[model samples]
Target: DGVEDDAMIQHAQVFGKPRTPDGRVLERALSARSSKSGKAYREVVKLIIRPPRAEYDVKKLGPTPFTYVRRFRGGKQTVMRTEFAVVNQRQDVELKCSQWKPVGAHLHELPCVLYLHGNASCRLEALQVLKVVLELGCTLCCVDMAGSGLSEGEFVSLGHFEKFDAEAVLHELRSGGRSNGKVALWGRSMGAATALMCTAKLDPLVSCVIADSAFASLPMLVHDLLDEKVGSVLVDACVEINQCVGCS
Candidate 1:
């Protein structure tokens, strides 16, 4: 009994029990594994909403005057940096943008392909496929999503709120005459989910959508992670506590 009590104390310290709004203990039957499951659920929620900000040298990717000479097009394309502000849920989000376009090409002339980076990543991730995009004869544009990289935001709602950011960027591009009204989306992971969500609403403006490694459902993904952490028996309880805490 003494050893059991000590184990319980250790579990309480490591994985706190779920509580009600008034701080009343809710589930006394919670084992150490169950407590761990609840903790994992909350941690996953925190991670999803506030992922670690990815920082890197923008100069290494390319700033203004960084030109790429096309082999067949017989001209040099340059990368240009731009900034725009988007207001979502009354939060002012300033997006840092970069455009790679052929020299002397008018913005309204070439089709634009907006690249959306994954979670905890910045616009510089587009550098991986920059050459392929350039070869496709389409203008490539990349932006730092809100709550990631240089964008201003306190939280990230994954595809829920990020889709709006993508929409706003597209709107700015078209309305401001920065784009030719022809746009394609290329997104990876979280960005892929955002692209799919945004495309559903703005199918008319989006010429194509290329989603890479997007989750089928966010909730299912969280559930699977929790199951892996603690097992199926505690998954429901953890999910319930997470929902109650408004993390879901």
Candidate 2:
């Protein structure tokens, strides 16, 4: 009975069960499985932590709705399409983006800065960033990663598949002609990993990558999460589940 109790507690802790992402409590847990459960146990653990429904429209955030489409695909026959409605939009001939230029901007092409947000987040989350671009005399384009915000997806794979999603945005910005033949990528949390992974693949893709609050390694983060919490029996299962979810 105690073992079952521990497993339930561990599962809830990792998956943000009982309480929702917004800090609301629902109080929930999956069926407990012992370390002896083998492969079946891992599968069950993996199945329990589904990504929350984080879909949101930027149009609803403000009155003036400016829409731009960013499309990509992943998994099996899954299409992730996003339309961002910003408080401001500058459809430069260089690319299809929500570009906000500095005050007194007379040029069509400006230094473009792409913003990437974290998990359970959307492009609208970059409100502060958009403002900074105005001060820097630059244009900002926020990206909505798959399975989050307006992007189409049932779940998020952390940074694993999101790497591809980030790269796609890189090419997307260059669809027409580049202002100066370079772009800067700035991302937070999971979005940071996506940004770093993209830079790793193609160093010249972006002028520079700014990653905020990104983990050094995913496994270490998982281990730390379970420290002093879950029992040894449930630790392996929980970590495996986390790896699957994170690595996607």
Candidate 3:
């Protein structure tokens, strides 16, 4: 049993190293030590990989009416709504997307603002700002990130994998001529981090990025959670285990 635990630690060492924004590897906090017991480590890893899924009644936000009226810039304006799907080529997941545009406005005429929802939230979360965006006269688009909403996926990777999902949506918008070539990203919490990560790869194409309440780092977030629940004594051990299991 000792040998098996050691083997798992060695295996995790191969995947736990974090990378800097420039792609440089950062020193691991617990590289030279292993947790005293693997039970807690395993539990933490399980929680990270399979977080609770956020399920809701799609019909409540549904049928995506053909058009909606909103008071924009002191006057009433009619906005057209369209629903569609985009395929995340990286994961082969279909992301459900919704777009709102000013009536009679062509896609090429207005800037597009893509909204990313927080953890445990779906595209419907974007409804909170629908009126504001409409008043700004920008085209608004929102998609259910894989695993979070009506999108296809079994788990959420915070930002690691969701970044690719965002990329796929951007690609669809650009290639499908869905926007005016100027796109902005707005996200909250986990979605905020996803926007930051996704924007790093497509800096030139993005006109602006607004990240709201993003965590400092994944490991730190996990450590804080562990510290709050189990105690600081197990924080390092749990985080170390998290990285080794490729859930970093």
Give the top-scoring candidate (lDDT): 3
User: After superposition, which runs of candidate 2 have C-alpha atoms over 4 Å from their true positions?
Assistant: 1-49, 60-98, 102-108, 226-235, 241-248
TM-score per model over all chains = 0.73, 0.61, 0.77
**Candidate 3 — worst ten consecutive residues by lDDT sum?**
23-32
Tens digit of lDDT per residue, candidate 2, span 29-73? 123353354444444343333345455655544443233222232
Tens-place lDDT per residue, model 3, 222-247, is: 77667666566556654554454444
What does the lDDT come to for candidate 2?
0.54
**Residues 1-248, candidate 1, lDDT per residue (tens digit)?**
34533443332333333556553333432343345454554444445556689877677666665677777767766755544555444346777777777667788888889999998888889989887887887878888888888778755666666787888878877887778888899999889988998898655569999999887766566676666765655555444433333333
Best-matching candidate per TM-score: 3
| Ten-residue stretch with the least lDDT total in model 1 | 8-17
Any residue pairs clashing in model 3, and if so which? 12-244
Task: Give candidate 3 misplaced runs (Cα > 4 Å).
Answer: 1-43, 62-72, 233-238, 241-248
TM-score of candidate 1 versus the correct structure, residues matched by position = 0.73
**Candidates sorted by lDDT, best first:** 3, 1, 2
Candidate 2 differs from the real structure by a C-alpha RMSD in angstroms, to one decimal, of: 13.7
